[model samples]
Target: MTDRSHITLYSGGHKGAESEFGQLAEQWGIQEVNFSFDGHTSIQRTRGMKVLDPEELDKGNVSMEIVSARMGRKFAHANKIRKVIQSIFHMVNNGYHVLAVGWIQPDDTVKGGTGWGVELAKLFNRPVHVYDQERNGWFTWKDNAWTAEVPELDRDTFVGTGTRNLTAEGKQAIHDFFTRAFGPA
Candidate 1:
């Protein structure tokens, strides 16, 4: 009766390792949902703009489109929370079963990227699998801790797991996992 299906990958857009990881997820049944702020504009547009228009607060689609343009150099940080919420809702409403969040290290800045995925996992009650080269970590009352117990992802650089190193076997594993979690697609 339950039509559990589809896995979504939320990463720091499709660039560098993040982009590569998205491709790997595609190999599996997991669909990479590019929540990148860059989808709205071209690189040329992001050149010198400083701040996003306040009016964009109400017009997300238009604001986001402008943000995507490279002319402003507008980072995806300012409205990431809203963006993730929108992205999650959009995907889930459309029938995605699980979400695979991609993350990188150096989690201290304003828009630390992985934090969005982790937050979304908690928000959606989905189990989060984080793959990073700097050891696996989990939040705690005092501080987060790292260990070897976390699941190792395929090494597509983006996957950043010890076991899942972007190999054919690793890619297959991701596909199987997504299928099991989200159902067919």
Candidate 2:
């Protein structure tokens, strides 16, 4: 098995998928960095947590109009979501590979805030993977289409973000992913 000591997982450390990723990263001896902002209370992983200040958060800011257009949906609480979106930018920006656990909508976008990170990964041309909970399979973005594949953590740094309402399958997928990449944690 490849040494995973140097691998770092960048995430938002929310309750479900992100928290599972963080926990698995710890179990596998991989470094983890969880990005957060003020007034954000849902973070589950505190290890290596980096609370982004307003200025740093602003660095990742984009117009809500652009985000809505890109996401193919509108945010009712644009002001509240802007900070989360900005923090996601930091997670995606710092990580080279993006792995998400969510539903891939018909529009070819992963669902929820995780979708924003996936979109950014696509726009940045970084390798992106999604373990669709609904589909119960892994898909990788290739040539503008999501192709089925068993993905591994090929990069030293990667972003792990996904839905807050993670299912048992999603949790197992993250565990299996780490096992496949690192073996016997």
Candidate 3:
């Protein structure tokens, strides 16, 4: 028998996708690692989450406010984003096939970061399955099946198999690809 390959699933704190992914992980016995910076703690603090300090999350945010802070803020944000992307890339490079599951919304800030996950998957030659918010009819196909509309990060990458929900076919594809790369479920 071959080894069961490990899959490193990249995720964020988006409640909806997080919950869905957490459920799937529970069902499948898959492990997940989430990457995040200070803002998460600050948001939680302001909202009175008692798990950790309220001030920790504000470090990056406060550094963004230093005098003549425009450039600092931009670089700080860019650096954080770069770190997050790098973390994802490192996980893939370390030989675990990745499953990047998270939110992709219409807002520009959120959308830009969503693309990073796609780019990371492409960089590692892995498949990225993006789950979007809107339940639109556009993703529906004549196959009488619906899927999430997944877009490519660049031209050289595998344009994802868009399925609104993770259909049995989609799951089979994932299972097959990973099994080929690693081994059986």
Candidate 4:
């Protein structure tokens, strides 16, 4: 029997976001979709019975203008950040590690939820690992920033190079790293 590990993946639908993580997850038989519901965009692609419709949201009588105003921000997009936080908790409650898949820029900086999620994870004192495409290795929160040695990824803005896929070796490293982190499950 295969020891399948449940992990929450922080990434977008782009090739760069999903490439290495998706490959490694598949190789280790891990699942990225932790929560799925109707009209969740990914529901059709995933098998989930939990149904979620906007009827309740509509009933709340919340204005789209308000939503748009809050969701659209200069530095922090409320929707994405809030969703990332919520999903991080959801994944943790369901026994899944929060993994952020991102890239490192030529100048070395990370933005968006890929970077912000790690910040939130640190505040929550949770374990957050990243498959850094730029450095071509696995990183974890430790001390005050991302480190490849010891244990844990610390708080720091991840480097970025924009959306990009991982190489074959990078993908394998992801699998190996997770195995070491979780150990047989």
Model 3 C-alpha RMSD to native: 11.1
lDDT of 1: 0.35
After superposition on all C-alphas, the RMSD of every candidate to the true structure, in Å, is 10.9, 1.2, 11.1, 7.5
Ranking by lDDT: 2, 4, 1, 3
Which 10-residue window in model 2 sums to the lowest lDDT? 1-10
The per-prediction tally of clashing pairs is 21, 0, 5, 16
Which stretches in model 4 have alpha-carbon errors above 4 Å?
2-33, 42-85, 92-96, 104-110, 150-169, 178-185
Clash pairs, model 3 backbone:
38-57, 147-163, 147-164, 148-163, 148-164
lDDT (Cα atoms) of all candidates against the true structure: 0.35, 0.94, 0.35, 0.44
Lowest lDDT block of 10, candidate 4: 153-162
Which one wins on lDDT? 2
Residue-by-residue lDDT tens digits, candidate 1, 58-175:
3333244433331223455656545533443333233222223223335321124334334433345443454333333322111243232334323222221122123344344444
TM-score of each: 0.38, 0.97, 0.39, 0.52
Q: Candidate 1: where is the Cα deviation over 4 Å?
A: 1-13, 26-39, 42-85, 88-111, 136-185
Off by over 4 Å in 2: 1-3
In lDDT terms, how accurate is model 4? 0.44
Give the worst 10-residue stretch by lDDT in candidate 3: 42-51
